[model samples]
Target: MNLKGIHHVSAITANAQKNYDFYTSVMGMRLVKKTVNQDSPSMYHLFYADAQGSPGTDFTFFEIPGAGHTYPGNQSISTTSLRVKDDAALHFWKDRFTEHHVDHDPIVELIGKATLSFRDPEGQRLMLISDEYNQGVEPGIPWSQRTIPAEFGIIGLGPVFLTVADITSTKKVLTEILSFKEISEVDHFKLFETGKGGSGAQVALIEDSEAKRERPGRGSVHHVAFRVADETELEFWKNRIEDSGMPNSGIVDRYYFKSLYFREPNHILFELATDGPGFTADEEFDELGKNLALPPFLEKDRTHIEAQLKPLQSSKE
Candidate 1:
């Protein structure tokens, strides 16, 4: 049961319309799904991904109005990184950000790859890394109406950075349980790789004992999901996690994929999700993200859910 890489990274946003605009128009990703959060039906849960809404390409957000700002500290996902074609793609994004008046940092070299760091409208940290090494790994499906061309468009997710208060226990869960191999270390940052060790396969842990713990709110990563091939693989992880004394949300049918959520030693939320039964399950391939989608369980309350959600404008509009 080998975990592939990231399935998706979910965050929180205070303003649904602003979040929709930045991810769809500015970032050039397709609004793969428009739905409401299962637990909190009044809040919108938006999914943005590649044209096909591939597993590793999803970056989601939950609308949580009036949520507090994220506290900068250890024990949280500090940044979510996306993979771009190469250095040229990074330059293209740089110019795009400048033209749109989006504040971003200059491209810098990290882990021997060109990286461009930036923030969303809500100040959630994001980065783009050159993926020349993993060009053909899984070049994501390009949205037809994308502002950026397919060649220089963003690929799947790249390495995600987690700030941990202590590396000892966290390292144990990552290596022994999750099957991550420690590839390298730079100063206090340790790099771990799963599967093929490029693009979405990497995760970086920054040891920062002196830093404070994080508070969940808008602009904070809610959870980071990792990919499992299918239900069999997901079950393997569920058992492994439970047997190892880790508490998990056992076997949840999330419509698009089955998932099991567990918190690591540092309290960072992690999810093991299946790869299939993708976004196309509830909607047609060409009509995805065109209307409100609800799981069968939530279908009965569709009218109420739609009434609670704010009307969002898509880039296609």
Candidate 2:
């Protein structure tokens, strides 16, 4: 089975309104869905993506106000890179971040590509990588209400960087179980790609055995999901992972998609998710993220869920 690419990256946020404004206004992404965390319905789980909420386009956050800061090191996904069109688009983003007073690093080259690194309000590490070779291949669906021009919009996810203690066992899990092929190595990072090796197909493993282990809290990544074609593929992977002695959460119906979650050798949570029954399953394409939608099982407790979540103000507000 071929694991297509990154399905989504889920991180933590301290303030829902601030996260909403930064992603929708400054970053030029579409807030595709608004829902509560399935396991804990009290917290808000927000989804941001391209217009259609495509598989690789999603970047989500869970609001946890008092959750302490993330200690970045081994066994954690430290950065989520978004793919932009080219170097010119990177320049545009750099200017935009400066104008908005966003905390960011100067543009740097990694793996022979121009990258603009930045952080959200909650200190979640993020980057914009200019895919010069694959320019315009995965263009973002622009939101008409976006402040930034459509041409410079963030297209989709790029390489997700995982800070690992070592690459030996992780490499086996990636290549043998997850279908990733080692593409290259730069500095201390070993790069792996799933499909044809472009944007949305990469995962970089940075080895630092002495680094401190990350504590999951605000500004930390909760999990990273990889895409499968359908339910059959998802089940196949679940069986394979189980047979290989890895612990998994089994198949879960997530309303929008079917998910099977497991921890890799480094203890980073990995999910195998399907591509069908997208964001439009519950809400219309035009009205997505406008209402707080919940799964059928949680519908009875909507009042309690809504009461626990703070009112999220969109950029337009």
Instruction: Estimate, for each residue in 212-245, the C-alpha lDDT of model 1 and write its tens digit.
Output: 8988788999999999999999989988988899
List of clashing residue pairs for candidate 1? none
Query: What lDDT does candidate 1 reach at residue 19?
Result: 90
Estimate every model's Cα lDDT from 0 to 1.
0.87, 0.86
Report the Cα lDDT for residue 157, model 2.
90
How does candidate 1 score on lDDT? 0.87
Model 1 TM-score, all chains together: 0.96
Output the TM-score of candidate 2: 0.96
TM per candidate:
0.96, 0.96
